[model samples]
Target: MDTRQRLRTSALVCAAAVGMLISGCSSGSSFSEASAPSGSSVASPPGAVSTEELKTYYAQRLSWRDCGVPGFQCATLRAPLDYAKPDGRSVDLAVARVKATGPGKRIGSLLVNPGGPGGSAVSYLQGYAGVGYPAPVRARYDMVAIDPRGVARSEPVECLDDKDMDSYTQTDQTPDDKPEVAKLSTAFKGFAAGCKSRSATVLPHVSTVDAARDMDILRGVLGDEKLSYVGASYGTFLGATYAELYPDRVGRLVLDGAMDPSLPARQVNRDQTAGFETAFKSFADDCVQRALCPLGTTSPEDAATRLKDFFAKTDAQPIPTGESRPLTESLATTGVIAAMYDAGAWPQLREALTQAMAGDGSGLLALSDSYYEREPDGTYTNLMYANAAVNCLDAPPAFTTPNEVDAAVADFEKASPVFGRGFAWASLNCAYWPAPATGSPHRIEAKGAAPILVVGTTRDPATPYKWAQSLADQLSSGTLLTYEGDGHTAYGRGSDCVDTAINTYLLEGTPPRANKRCT
Candidate 1:
């Protein structure tokens, strides 16, 4: 609910990348999508604007150039506060793009989203997605990132001050009693209320659908005839929505760690709970086999039981890390959970866990700090706040009451005996959100769109592998590209088979087939 939790998934993407990014591909080149998004449908939100209204909202906007840096041009575009009233109030969206350094071939502009539904597309463009994308693709097209409305540097939605966020992040995730459950609920409510009071105007406009529409405007502003994009994690959902809403405008799209729009909110939460469990199992299996594993068990199941017991102990008595704050079960779990996103962090995770279980909590504490983007100096990024705001608004809260949470806990526990209970409650942050749901889960057919690549990892933590399969099946033009490996996302997570296949598609306009699988 507070900004910290809101950006949890997005921040985890970065924290786990402290080392991965060091070795990631960074040279860039570019090339660029087809028809409308034609999958399944959810009922349109009330006051849905017509295409003309949407177009008018985009066209009337003025852009002012600002110096983002040496190589990129930055501007802000105004879109209607509410799309249905095109002539009404407006909100500014920050946009950035580095023009292609073409001495090669001019393909087109390519928009890139680095997940986060809450992640800053502009930051992603400048930092990771833009500069680090493969060279051939970068050389051919201008690389761009748009910070979604209600996200960082775009009239952001604020939910907590630094102090309040600190408390919110340390709130007990595993409820041991009625009072603890109430505390958790209160934390969720307080976090939600902060957003309502601070960012009331635009909370309603931050849905995935709204972001998708905004992407279209960016396409028009960039002078691109169609939308060409690469979206990772939740960005996959935004990209799919764009394809569905403006199928005719979809040019070339690659959705990595795709979300299955057909799953209900609770189902989505449960499935993700299971995914973390699966990832943990993989971690445990590998951990026990390694010399450094501190939990010390021969089998993954035993290692998992050891972790659950450790969490239970932390809940009963949290361990101090010598900081002003101690390591609570919630923070500890979050730290471990964060590592599940990328296998590259497995070594660090092992070290962190060993230190924590041995009474030296600095390593696990540091991992949690990284995941929360809590800098060593104690300041925090707005990523978590935006992550929660967008997630809560795009869909209904996952649970209505503690009983509902309790009912789901058994299944969640079964899914990943170590992570299920905590994630089940983490999903509840939206239950107390102030914004009403403007979107519902629905399958995107993308029937008339060109072939779209849907990449998935077998052991992805945030967006599970099955969701990718389901999404591919749901989309009329969907092609499933499988990486039988570990990590939250594919594409550039270090695989020649995976990287070359996707690069070929982005560069040559040839999507791997629906059943394509790479080791």
Candidate 2:
């Protein structure tokens, strides 16, 4: 729930994508009974696994069964817990697929990942991608998804329990003074410690590189010579990593809402702050024209001031919701940040802001709950925990201490006057992470890879358009497809141009022209 983590976690496509696919239903499934055994760890040195070592994994065939959801088949695939030692402890990855409903000759399996480093790919496949992707695309390609290690249903990393998590989510992220800062630091330490205590076995191995390797294993298991994928948000990073490691294995890939792998963690967080600021201004401009503008009717600047003032007021005196927990400044900020991911949520945000301004914090609090994936019964999905795990492992922390955060506050605030301070402090959490970072900022030039499509939305709040541009430039064969619009991702958000370009690329293996723009 920390805003700093929102830098990459913002690519979480579940909330909006699932909402569009299914009404009034949870997008996640509890695959606990099918989860792999935990508590096994081994030191596997980093390097290529010899083909001999990987033969067992590659030769294994999936035993698919009815997934209990009509038209879907579920199965589990075994991968090395540590790839360096393929014969060592193994992990089971949950995979789901809806075979191609073909009128045209079947092309191949199309793997889709909807951006949460922690997002449940299985659930996404069931709730959205498998059912909601464009018909022509789905008809020729067997839609597929795999829950990566330490994500939902795949030996998930457990941090704080439900009650502790609720308290953690409510923890004040933007400290006003020394004691508050110390308290915030303690909360972060506690969350990290909880993860270490609960998920020691899988902590070190859930890095993005590891997940990308798992994707390759999946590709082989699916009998596909190359990977045909559509990765959004953090999934873009995942796909790019796969291409970087195995350039020849790259097939049709559409990396929507692309993330730049070359930027350091702090820069990523700061850039995202600016991205959210851009999105908020868009919202503000739209809001002030409405009859019930809670922020202000004067100008976007006035609206921002009012929103900041409202945040300050809530910080001073938390607003009470109908429930036992009141809406704190942290929760309110999360609520607003959640809405920024998709413009579709703007009206909901307007209503929530209006209700909060009228002293009812329930609406905003509900938005916060949705962002955290907290269920009505107060239990939570493993999304946030896995988000922290994967992200913390993928790159070094944004800040090593409170002093660094304090020093960077001015820069962050300059980037985003409203959400900057909170986001800067939120970046401090990963500094207390239990495992050392296994990866670092590095460019991914997938030299000799097949042409990969990179899609960017003009006002994408989470993964900014600039990141997409940077990613496209970095990948040797990457083609940029620009959507001059708002939202976290471009394709399937009702843009015929974007969809047509991607579908054509998927079917015909021809990427759109470089820098193709669509409104």
Candidate 3:
């Protein structure tokens, strides 16, 4: 993803929040029953077990009990305390599932992850993916979700309190002077220190690779010889890592809104910045043709100029939104940027901008609130805090100092001429992290894995299409599936072609022909 896009994407809880969503998983060991088991249910480990043995492992251990998701059941599985040190202590991973609702045929369990790097996969299963997945596909495969360690219900990472998160989200992402810069740096340090102090032991184990390993253990517990998964956004990274680490264990896998791990933090950030520009241009093009465009501009550039001007004005003089605090530039920009993701949100953004420009700030404020997952009562979710903590630990900082970030920001602005600066500077957050990075960008090539489907949206703002291409190129068994549309994710967002292709692959263990494009 480009920098500006990454900033907006990541900023939406931190680009990491735009992960996938699945429904139907709870917290203990009783998943619903499947109609019939397929012969290839559990994948066979290299030269270790036969397919029949793997199937037996799954058939015998899958105890069905009612989970909170009415028809679903929850289960806990024990994994090694550390993959690197398999003989150490043990960590219990929370796994949930909804058995295929059919009496006809059953494939092994299909695992799904919504990509927060910290998003609760089990929650996704219980709430969305388990039930909402294409019905035909759901009828044939046991749907499952496992909340990775350091995520919700799986030894979650607690960085800051609600008040701390509120302050962190409202802190100026754009600094005007040395003191402001120091304040920004202090906020980063404080947030990082909070994670280190509150969730220290688990910090070292939250990397994408570690999460991938955890998934493998879940695969073993479920008696699936191979892992079948649908990962969105950051989950794509996780899925891809699994493919790389245990290629031979990969069953029908799909990665949506794929991220290219081979790219350095800065390049990924910049590319995402450009992506937002593309999405913005699409929004602006639609807005300008309308008679009521808030900007009253003829072109996207003019609309962007108007936005920058408004942001500057807000920075100089905050506008009261009928709340205790007034709207600032950062908040205003965040609100505007949030709308650029899905074109369906454009009209709402236009109305919000019009109201903001006309001296009323509630509209824009509301947008910001939604983007930050904040309620009208000034309460906040832990999404942002969790986002930052996970991101800071997953990758090292792109730059080491404010000056370096400033230079990068200038370059970003030159590239986007709109969102570059804001996003570029946002990248600096990791630079000020109190704890050193526990992970760095790495390439994942699931060499011996089955065909893995990698999905990309051509105009996706959060994770640009190029990322999918990059990831497909990097993975040994990667197959690129393109959605020629606009949106963050494609599966259930309304593309028959995208959905059909993925559903077919998920249900029948088929991969879309390599480099397939759909609209």
Candidate 4:
């Protein structure tokens, strides 16, 4: 898994903004939680803020209002932009929630995050999890989401404008020479500059650790005894960090499509590249069984080879789509990456590939558009900007220079021939970030936390299953739940065994047997 795959892995909350891949809130001006996170920081974590210091913040009341949606409430709360200076500036966090629906004993609040560190938890809660989650769980607990600082509805990080981003995303990531490398470098520099200039106040404060602290704030404000969470994809990282910081406050954590906090940015990206290859192979195998198979062969290697040939062809002479923009190799690869997220989207990928192979690039273009959250009008959201902001701040760049990336290509190629070079170069986006990272590469053992459930899918493209295993192994009381199937995450994707186990945990607080494997 190289870095490009990691970027594609950030979901827009639990709801699919473009309906492509998977992955919010409440406020009261005031509520009474009997106790807040203690000063006790297990493992002697230096980052944890003592309960005494945060009392004023925890006691602050939120002024909730009826948002556009019925049964959904929205509000804003202020979190210190930087935890180091608690008396310093603050950033507004957007929150939303749907109250429990059933007449059962309420089980407190159930907070959900849909993977991307930048994903909008408010939109997710309002659109999907708030209503789509299991009835029993919904009945028992209020579904909550918070647009973590520097995310949508929060103080979002803004980079390039739409037209500029259109040009930026199409920049050739697999640069072959010095001139091309400089072009890619310029794009990255411009993107980092854009964020720093437009969102300087917020960009430096959006690290996962900052977000984890915000989650504790949410737990305190929600008046919950502990934090019960369902975090997917990159959200798993946030949840784990929270556990690491507030081990005593952990309650029924389900880290679906879990990420290993121990792995640095480069290793994570490389692993994700391999995961994409695994998923691509699965898609290819499935494609061969269909009549519209674009690769037109049963061999997965041959399929990859043929697809590479298509990318080369597009690189030289981009195919014409219905729109003015031609389908370049970069765009085509983005389209393919988008589909590799979910097995359900394989048919769409095949059709897109088939259409592209026939010189009509509309289908592929749409997929690429969806992945980037690009609208037809050429406007764009801040997903990519916040993604880079949080990611770069959470960990240092995988490569600091094009030469370093060149040196890493061989290992990445060994990981995934299809995505290695592109992803490796893609990692350079953070090298030029203006803010020095606040966090470092370290393991979150959560040494005193109660049972934390880490879920994994066998062939998940974005977050590989091994990450879940690693996370479960590292945590003080983490339980590994294996979903032996495909797609990004395991729960709520039609696996009866996986759903039942998670539902049981989320509902009853009784975790499945350790290392439980569900097919």
Candidate 5:
């Protein structure tokens, strides 16, 4: 993640107020009876305990109880809140799995993680991956997910309440004065303090590396000899870390919408800003040909200029939606960002922009809601909270202060006039984090791991294509699967080419030829 969805993808800003509908994750048909033996389930380590206290954790019996879905059973996974103190406190992680329905022999477990450092892997599996995965793949393997610590339902981290978040999200990110900057800084500090207060232990332990360790524990507990996994966006970082930490134990790992752990937080955020610009150009290229385009039927550059001007206008005079909340500059920019996540959202963006230009902000508010994941009940998910928690712990802040962001403004503006300013400011979200970053920008060369597949979309807004190439090049046995297209991720986004290659790898243990391009 950029270090916010520059750490998780933008939560739905406006529309999530109704109910956020993210694409992918189909609700599959009813699941069949469990085929795997329960006795084989992992249990606490027996005999003399070694120095590795984690071994004891890896051996615990995970009691599975049927959740809402037919074959999907929920279980609690316990891991040390602080890996450095493994003999100390434990955190109960939420895990869910839908056993494979097979005509072929069961092929162990396939763990799936959606992009958010904070995105609920359990929800991703139950909603999409469990039933939405390839039929052959589903038939041969069990689909599983776990909510990493500090994320949803896994000792979730809490920050601002609904009304406070409403105000926070509306706070002027593109501050024009010292007062605005102070207000933004205060909000950042306040959010960090809230996480520290509510999730003191969990907050410090939710880094990507920590999450990877949790995955290894989950892998052992699931009775899998080797870990087979699929992770997207920030999830890719988690998967890559796992492969690096436990190379020999890696079965088949797929990293879609890959993040380059090699880059600093600023570079990642800056690169993502550019990537979103790339996506915007793609959107503008398409929009200019459409009459509904609010930016008018003009060149991409021209379209971007007009859109920037629109943000300027909204910034000056917030657009009033039918609701009490009016669309502010930050919300408007986020609304624009939500649409850039997937090409399918372009039309909605165009409509939203048109409505905003028409002085009705409801459409744009909905788009912003999509970015924030604010539900109709006005309750927010732990997404943004955990996103910042994990992101801040993974790396240092992009800008140490508002002044630093100001100093870098020109560089960012040079990066993307439309998004640079907003992203530069967004990068500072972790600046006031209570805990210092535990990890730094580095390479994860999973030397002895089985072939790990890295999927890169040509114009991914969040995780850019270059990141996949970089990660593929860094990994000892990495294979790059290029989706020569637009959007955040390639898998199951109407791409038989991308899906087939990934499916073959998962089922047959065949990696796509290195640097293979799929259209």
Candidate 6:
């Protein structure tokens, strides 16, 4: 499994915490809003295509209709399949919005993305941001979301079918020998091949850069002179890419759980491994304090040792989960990692671990299923498929061969003794990608951009706090907002200070003071 896929929004994590097991909250849709007129030309940065060539695309109007959900309208926006070939084929992007409900003067649209590179931004809007955002913020700005190209509702990438995906997920990630390594490699290759065979046309175009460009077009279609946005996890990378591509068009952008674009693929995986370890320690600390702690009422280090022992036990003999599929080490590890994304889920994780340790693997298996967006019927959302597509296209593979991974094992192990080996091996999935990487690790400094807020959780598991610091330092107008707490992203996660600062920025165009720390 790709570790980067863990960079999903806290909304999903909170869903798991609240026992909305199968999938998150459902969204209602209805149509009653008029379409926003296409605005004047939005200039592209130097070296981009001339605005004249893209006039047709920028000027096209969106026809909004009820999206089967109350209070939400959906529309499709057409963008070039390949930007270089503007006159060639096109890809349709799904866009959704809830018009501002205001007692105050309406601000412009506030586009929200919940990471995943694959997460359904539209679903996020209707299910969370559109209704759950602070009433004051929602009362002013129209909440908008566009599922980036090759994401949900758009042309999503398809990989292995359900049965094959089950086998793939159960594959041993930490190889004990040559045969195990070969088996893992074959699974990776098969996943890539399946994507190639099923989604050949759109796989290569799902890079973050392409998604960023799509955001610009969406901005124009919505008649926003400058984009106001909230992007989490990988969405932060997407938002940063947008600021870099069109600095002057950026407005009131908040990149919570920010990622550093400068890190290579290997570094990203390794850092995420360390990040998981950090979060695990936090969980372990809390777990030991509970009288019913499954790992024993011992120190955090002892809990880690016990957890590793459990993994080894599962590796040797898979635990039956009541379902046809058994709980293997990979699934259990994924389950644990999923819980690390939000502290609210720690209780669920503790219970899952308790059950797994007691020979009942149902809880852990369910958590793993949730992480993969697996439906109770065995179908899966296209989240993982698009996740791999975007991640692989955004950066070169972390390792070209098994030997490289073997060589880096020590570093990975040092970074995360429990998860490092699996994360190190997971990075190899992109090595078998059919398309070459279209992007590389580089610094992004949107020099002429308006103030951008970068939020970080001190114990964030997916995107490390250090990454937010790095991203804040990198962006020319970036300001850092630190949440001295746990969870993936900070805003809308119960931190009054964090929400107030971000809300102030969005409403009044005033960013939080640099290095402001909130609890």
What's each prediction's clash count? 38, 0, 46, 22, 28, 5
Off by over 4 Å in 1: 1-45, 54-57, 60-68
Cα-based lDDT at residue 353, candidate 2: 92
**What tens digits encode model 1's per-residue C-alpha lDDT throughout 28-55?**
2121221112223222457766554555
- Candidates 4 and 6 compared: the better one by lDDT is 6
> How accurate locally is residue 371 in candidate 6, as Cα lDDT from 0 to 100?
83
lDDT by residue (24-139, candidate 6, tens digit) is 10122221112111223223433356555666776777888899989999989888998777888999999999999997998888999888767899988887788889999999
lDDT of 2 by residue, 299-392 (tens): 9999999999999999999998999999999999988988887777787889889999889999898888877788878889888888888888
Ten-residue stretch with the least lDDT total in model 3: 18-27
- RMSD to the true structure for each prediction, in A, is 5.5, 6.7, 6.2, 4.1, 6.5, 5.3
Query: Where does candidate 6 stray beyond 4 Å?
Result: 1-9, 13-48
Runs of candidate 5 exceeding 4 Å displacement: 1-51
Name the lDDT value of residue 472 in candidate 4: 93
lDDT of 2: 0.82
Q: Which ten residues in a row have the lowest lDDT in candidate 5?
A: 15-24
Error of 1 at 351 (Å): 1.1
Task: Give the Cα lDDT of each candidate.
Answer: 0.75, 0.82, 0.71, 0.79, 0.78, 0.82
lDDT, residue 288, model 4: 76
How well does candidate 3 match the true structure in TM-score terms? 0.86
Against the true structure, what is each candidate's TM-score? 0.90, 0.92, 0.86, 0.94, 0.90, 0.93
Candidate 1, lDDT over the whole model: 0.75
* Index of the highest-TM-score prediction: 4
